[model samples]
Target: MLIGLEIKNFAIVSNLSTEWHSGMTAITGETGAGKSIAIDALSLCLGERAEASAVRPGTDKAEVSAQFDLSNLPLAHAFLEENMLNNDDNECLLRRVVCKNGRSKSYINGSPVTAAQLKELGQYLISIHGQHAHQHLLKAEHQLQLLDAYAGHHNLVNAVSQRYKQFADLQKEFKQLEQQQQQQAAQKQLLEYQVAELDEFALQADEFEQIEAEHYKLSNSQTILQVCQRELQHLYENDEQNACSILQHSAQQFTELAQYDESLASVATLLSEAAVQVEEASREVRNYTEQADLDPQRLTEVENRLSGAMDLARKHHIKPQELVGFHQTIAQELESISNNSSRLEQLEGEIEHALEDYQNASEQLSASRHQYANTLNGLISESMANLSMENGVFEIALTAQNDRAPNSLGFDNVSFLVSTNPGQPLQPLAKVASGGELSRISLAIQVIIAQKVTTPTLIFDEVDVGISGPTAAAVGKLLRQLGKSTQVICVTHLPQVASSAHQQFFVAKEIADGETFTHMLALNKDGRVNEIARLLGGDNISKTAKANAKELIKAHG
Candidate 1:
């Protein structure tokens, strides 16, 4: 239930605060007096789209916040707890801010959140029926929604939707498999030939690099052997002027000097280490040179291997290093082509199973909807009779369409047909019902559906729009009854409707500081009488109007 609303600089409402209580609260005002502004503020708190124009001309931003009592609204509490936004107290605050630059922000329980979350919480806290809600009844899709809502078939609808999704997903997989089969079939011969060619090459990992290395070694064996011998001679075997011989002479000179200065001993050790290292290096180089002789037979074999790799790589439009990967890919493609028929059959079988599941769920859903259609028609017709249309005939016509492809909502088409006169034949609401009758039907449907709604509050923006007389009284009483189980707030102009509110708020416009402003005040009993009397008598309230207002109030009480 909504406990409070605070709005600042929103349109003409500059810093308005109001406390709400349980039960029906009627908001009354003259035209252009900002009754709808209050509803708009509530909608802003409920995550409606905000525009820069919503801010007053002199203000930089507009803010609207609503407080809800969560003590009895279990669904709201669950939502808050699930989101970790629940506070210690059994109350939640929803806040919205709209900047003059057309930016908007939303909050729940002082925690910043997205507009979608606010909308989600708003679903559990408030349901609004605006002045144009009657036109919604003209749409068959909306009628179907209304029927399902009234029948409390939310779970069934969800089940059917889930089944449809399963079927759709399976069908998508089947189509993709079929397409893959067709594509692969067209390319199968080419792929098989490629695989055979690659297999004939018989490429192995690391063979290309190893063979190249061997080819390099065999092709340059004589040069390598000579270089090795030259290195060995330069290091140690060259006469007198080689690096090892020069180092030995320097070591001798340094050793003699160190002998004279006591550092000569360390230099002597260095000369000994240099001679030993040179000898070992010379032996290793000689060993390699002796083993470096070429074999023409092995050389020819390596050249043949490299030539084969290059030719095959060129033929396949790839480098020699990529041959292994190309071979693997072709092999996998051949395997898949071999298994494509079996895979398609597998997908088809799964699709058939999914189709069966979807058909079962949809058929059950259709049967349930058809069964509830009669009950809903009877309830709506009776509700219309209570609203003073004693001859109203309502029918929920369900057409099972076999040729129509199953959609997310199932295979049945639902249309609402109505007749407002005794001898009239039932026709579509758009073709048959007058504006007043539409309003009544809309109201009757709302009243019937409200019983099944778990939301704790509902707002009606002058549901009595095209209604008056006894019918208006009946609408007001129906709202009051709805308020018995849910918090009801109605913005209305009719005294008959306003009189039925447990609480009343009178809205009026004021010209302050040369700017238009809107203000709302909670009306006490005396104030309620005066407001209702004003609604009855306009600017001139007579004793009879006051008396009639008092009688209407007393009767509603």
Candidate 2:
């Protein structure tokens, strides 16, 4: 139940804060006096899309806050708990702020949340039936949705939709695969030849770099051997003027001088180390000269291998190192195409199974719709009789579209049929009902559906648009009856409806210093009489109007 609403700089509402109570509350005001401003503000808190124009003429933003008592709303409590938006007390505060730049933000319990989250939670909190709700009753789709909502088998309806989607997706995949079968077969043959060619070469990872180094060495074997032999002769093999012999002679002289000067000892040590290093270098060179030998046959084989790899890389339009990765790609494609026929067969079986599942769920939903349609027909028909059309008959016509393909909403085409007079034949509601008759029927249906809903609050924004007099009284009675169990706030112009509410609020527009503002005040007993009198006779109230207003209150009370 909504307990409070605060609006700041929202449209013509500069600042307004008010508390609400359970049971029916009537919002009444003269035309163009901003009667629905509070409703509009509450809608913002309930996650309605915002517009910059909603802001006051000079303000930068508009803000609205709504508080609801959650003690009786376990669904709402569970929602807040699941989202971590719960508070210490059993209450929920929803806030919305809209800026002048057409941007907006939402909050739950002072925690920032997405507008979508607010909408999701709004389902369990309140349900709003706008003034134009009766207009949508003319649409076929809306009729079907209303029937389904009234049926209250959302899980079964969802199951049918899900199964239909699965069936449709499989059918689409099967069609695409069937169309590509011939093209894929042709590509498969070419891929088989290319994969076979790569299979014969069978290049290993990193083998290209190793083989290239080996090929370079074999091609320059003689030069490497000659260089090693010359280095060996200069460093160790030559007896005179050799590097090792010269360094040894220098070390002996330095050693003799070191006996006289200590600094010369260090120089002798360095000379000895250099002689030893030169001897080791000469040994390495001799070893290389012994091992290095040209094998033209192996060289030719390596060169042929390198050339073949390069050629294959060129044919595939890739680098030699990429041959391995490219080979795997083509092989996988070939394998996939080879299995296309088998996959197509598998998809066919799956599509058949999905169709069966869809049909089963759809049949179940159809049966549920039929079962509940009778209940709705009886209830709405009874409701309409009380709404001034005593002879009016309401029925839900369910026709099976067996010839049509399966769809998400199942296989039934639903129509709301009505007969307004005693002798009239049942006809489509849109074709048979007058505007006033439609409004009454719409109200009846809304009342019926609201009874089945678990939402704690229901707001009717001028849903009593077309009817008046006794019929209007009936509409108010229905709303007030609903208010007995759920909170109802109705924006209405009829005094009959206003008097029917447990409480009444009067909205008035005031202009001061060239600025307009909307104000709402809760009406007391005498205030309600004056307001209802104003509704009865307009701005100029008469004694008779006040007397009639009092009588209305007394009768409804």
- Quantify how close model 2 is to the true structure by its C-alpha RMSD in Å: 6.0
Q: In lDDT terms, how accurate is model 2?
A: 0.92
Please tell me which predicted candidate would have the highest lDDT against the true structure. 2
State the C-alpha lDDT per candidate.
0.88, 0.92
What candidate 2 gets wrong by more than 4 Å, as runs, is 175-186, 198-314, 317-325
Report the C-alpha lDDT of model 2 over 1-557, residue by residue, as the tens digit: 89999999999999999999999999998899999999888888888899999999988999999999997888888989999999999889999999999899999999999998998889898899999999999888899899889888999999999999999999898888877878777788889889999999998988788789999999889888888888888998997779999999999999999999989999999999999999999988888777776789999999998999999999989999999899999998888876777889999999989988988898899999999999999999999999999999999999987667989998899889999998999999888999899999999999999999878889999999989999988888999999999999999999999999999899999999999989999999999999999889988999999999999999887
Worst 10 residues of 2 by lDDT: 286-295
TM-score of every candidate relative to the true structure:
0.82, 0.81
> How far out, in Å, is residue 130 in model 2?
0.9
Residue 271 displacement in candidate 2 (angstroms): 26
